[model samples]
Every structure is written in structure tokens, then in C-alpha cells.
Target: MTGVVGPGAVWLVLRATVLVVVAALLQVTVAADLEVLDGRPDLVVIAVASIAILQGPSAGAVAGFAGGFLVDSLGLGVIGSTSLTLVAVAYGVGVFGEGLRRTAAVRPLLAIGAASLAAGAGQLTLALLVGSVPQASPALALAIVPGAMLDVLLAIGLYPAVRLLLRRRGPRTVSLDLGAARV
Candidate 1:
């Protein structure tokens, strides 16, 4: 038990630390716009949500808070907005992912849709609170749908790869036959 717990604890801490650092770096260096469209990929948000889905809601929430706080600290937008958005996104991904996991084909698509919805809704809510809703043609709400769809598409392309890497390297259990191993 001690062996299991100790290693698991270490792995968890290490994983969380790495996730935070990577997310922060991505947020700081990567331009949100992807050139494919006039927008950038929300890699930080997606990372947080993916971690949460893979780890569970609590881990996701923690990752979300850390990632969002970092994003806010960068002065991209009002503080707490990203935090709130990420927490919600993480939770939704964790919950919905359970159901979607049953069908292999649907998991990626579901992740994409859920991730986009969470990010767009969070951003829209922030815009409303900050009173800077984009008001030109189609209105801000209309943009949310398309923006979220784009996010989903991006997630579909990226989530599978991330998932595969995470799963492949995840902690494993090994047994050694000590008595029979004497050479």
C-alpha cells in the first residue's frame, strides 16, 4: 500500500506541475490565432479541460484554476474570467467524457464539442460582465456558435494525440517473481 500510495502521489504532483508549466508556456508564447482561421487555438483551456477529463474533476478544477489564473495574470482579459471559464469547462468535460467514453468514435467529437462550448460560453459570460460584448454584425452571441465549432474542430484534431500520449506513458503496475528469479 505504501509503495502504491507513494508512487501515485509523486506521479500526481509531477503531472500537475508539468501541466501547469506547459499550459503557462503555451499561453505565453503561442498566439491564440491559428492562421487557418482568423482565430487562435485556446491550447491552455483545452489542456486544462483535457487534464481534468483524464484526471477527474478535482484535478481538472485545480489545473483550470492555475491555468486560468496564469492567463489572467498575463493581462489578456479581466481577472477571474478565465478561472471561472476553465473550472466550468473542466467540470463539464469530466462529466460528459464519462458518457462519451463508451463509444470510441464519439469521444473525440464529444470532447471537441464540449471543449468549444465551455470556452465560448465562459468567454461570452466574461464579455457580458465586462460590458465589452462585440456588437457589430451577427452580434457576440452569434459568434459564440461558430467560434465554438471551430474550437471543436481543433480539439478533434488534437485531443486524440494528447490522449494517446498520456495513456501510453501513464503509470503501470509490474510484478516480479522474486523466488523464481534467482539466476
Candidate 2:
């Protein structure tokens, strides 16, 4: 199976798996309470969504599922909530790639904003749906905004690196001319 797998497919799987693990570790260790303006930056989701959008719907969906699952497992948030939100955001971003690719600056900003909003809304909706209306804390919301903004900032900084990495891992196509002279 490994021998049969295309280089690009293998790279994507390996990259996605590594990213999920790193993101989970970041969420558990470095990201804890590292607040900016009271917001907790969600780098994992933003990175996952940004990459997914750059790739395609299928890639984005896979990344989203993995990222969300990692987030749920590492964070104290509800299960499946982040997963659902990430999947939706990844698909949405992937669908907009054409337009986004046209405007390079817009992509990161949009990815950050969309991922942040989706994550916040997802958590809120999950809480409500589960009949556990944890008292909405204004302080918590305030903290989250800054964190989300930080995530956006991080996305801006990291997009190029991610693109380069993906490109390096992508499949290469070789072209041959049938009518050319043979040595």
C-alpha cells in the first residue's frame, strides 16, 4: 500500500497527522491561558482551515476532522463541537479558494476571521444544544476576541510557510515527447 501510494497523497497524510499532533500538543501546553486581550488564540483551527482552503475541499475536510478531533481531545470544550465547526469552515474556505487565491492578503484575514467566528459560534451552539447554558462570561468573551485576533495574526505569518511546505510535498508531473529523438 505504501509503495502504491502517490507521493502527494502520502505527504498529505503524513503532514496532516503531524499537524494534528503538534496542534494538540500546542493546545495542551503552550497555548494555555496565553491570552491576548482576554482571547485565547486558536492556532490549531486557524492553521487547519488556512491549509484546507489552500488545498481543496477534500483536503480541508480531512484536516478539519483531524484538527477538530485533536482540539476536542486536548481542550476542555465539548466533543464534536470543534469538529463540526472546523469541517464547515474548511469546506467554506476550500470553496472560496479561487477568489481567495486571487487576493493573497485577503486569504489569511478571511481564514482567521472565519475560523474564529465559527469556533466561537460552534462552542456557544454546542453549549446551548446540550442544555448546559454555562453562564456567558463577558470577561471570557473579551479574552477570546484577542486570542482569535492573535490566531489571525499567526495565520498571516504562517500562511507562506505552510504553502511552501505543501508545495514541497505535492506531487510532481513529468512530461515526455513521443516524437523526440531517442538517445
Candidate 3:
């Protein structure tokens, strides 16, 4: 409303871009390679989900696409596959948030955990669909919880920073149904 594109939206997108890119770089250079508790924390997934929780489905999907593309490009993976998985994860989480009347501080935690699990599962499923047998084993199932927990921990800090960056004087994000969390 104020500019060709509202300054708020531009700031939000810029912040998201920085967060996604930085997190992906960290994931590629550090986090993804570092094993903790038998699994790695998905920095890009956490970052995208953190921003999506604030930005809504469309923005979330965009962040997801960027983060996923970074992973696909920076690491050994098929293009568009990780992108598709993260898009679904971001979109689903944003839609779920849209139905809520309010959110507690715990909401971000829950959302991050769910998104992490979903991201992991989505990646696995898409890989399988593409004929990539990713060495499935019993340990893989157990890693889900650890990975999600680690992601939630990372998101605890990441979400607040993203929310702050995206914050505007009034409501800036458009929810799917014009509803938003009271938090």
C-alpha cells in the first residue's frame, strides 16, 4: 500500500531470504554434516518453518522452495525434489496456523517439531518415489524424534528473530482465511 510493494512485505521477504540462505549455508557447511544424537538438525527446515509460522502459506512455500533448492544444490540431491518436500511442509504448517484463534509460546515449538518430522518424512518419501533407495533402517525411525527435537531447539531462537524482522506496525501477513493467531 505504501510502495510498489509494501515495505513490510519487502522486509519480510528479504529477511526470509537471508535466513534461508544463511541457514542453508550453515546446514551445508556445518549443521548437516555434524551428527548429534545420531541425527543432524535441519537448519533450513527450522528456518523456513520459523518464518512460515509468521509469514503464512504462500511466503512459507517460497521460503521452503529457496531453502530446499539450496540443499539440493549445495548437497548431493536431486533438484526440485527437496524443493517440493519443503514447500509442502511450509504450506501445511502455515495452513494449520491459519485456523487458530491464538497461539501460545509453545505454538512455535510444536510447529517446529511437526515441520521437522514432516520435512524428514517428505524428503524420504520423495526420494523413494524417485527411485532413490536411501538406506532405510530401524534407526531412521528413531532419528525422527531426535532430529525434530534438535530442530525445535534451533527454531526456538530462529523463530523469534524471524518474527521480529517480519514484524510491522499492523497486520502485514495475509492468512488464507483472514484469520491469525492472537499471539
TM-score between candidate 2 and the true structure: 0.78
Q: Per-residue CA lDDT of candidate 3, range 70-170, in tens?
A: 99999877978889989999998887766643334678779889999998888777766677866776676666888898888877777777777666645
lDDT of each: 0.65, 0.70, 0.78
Runs of candidate 1 with Cα error greater than 4 angstroms are: 1-5, 100-105, 134-137, 168-183
Ranking by lDDT: 3, 2, 1
TM-score of 3: 0.82
Per residue, candidate 2 scores C-alpha lDDT tens digits across 123-142 of: 66676668677676676445
Highest TM-score: give the candidate number: 3
Q: Which ten residues in a row have the lowest lDDT in candidate 1?
A: 1-10
On the 0 to 100 scale, the lDDT of residue 117 in model 3 is: 93
**lDDT (C-alpha) at residue 72 in model 2:** 80
Q: Write the per-residue lDDT of candidate 1 for residues 145-172, one digit (tens) a residue.
A: 6556665676675666556534424456
Highest-scoring model, lDDT? 3
Output the worst ten-in-a-row residue range by lDDT, candidate 2.
1-10
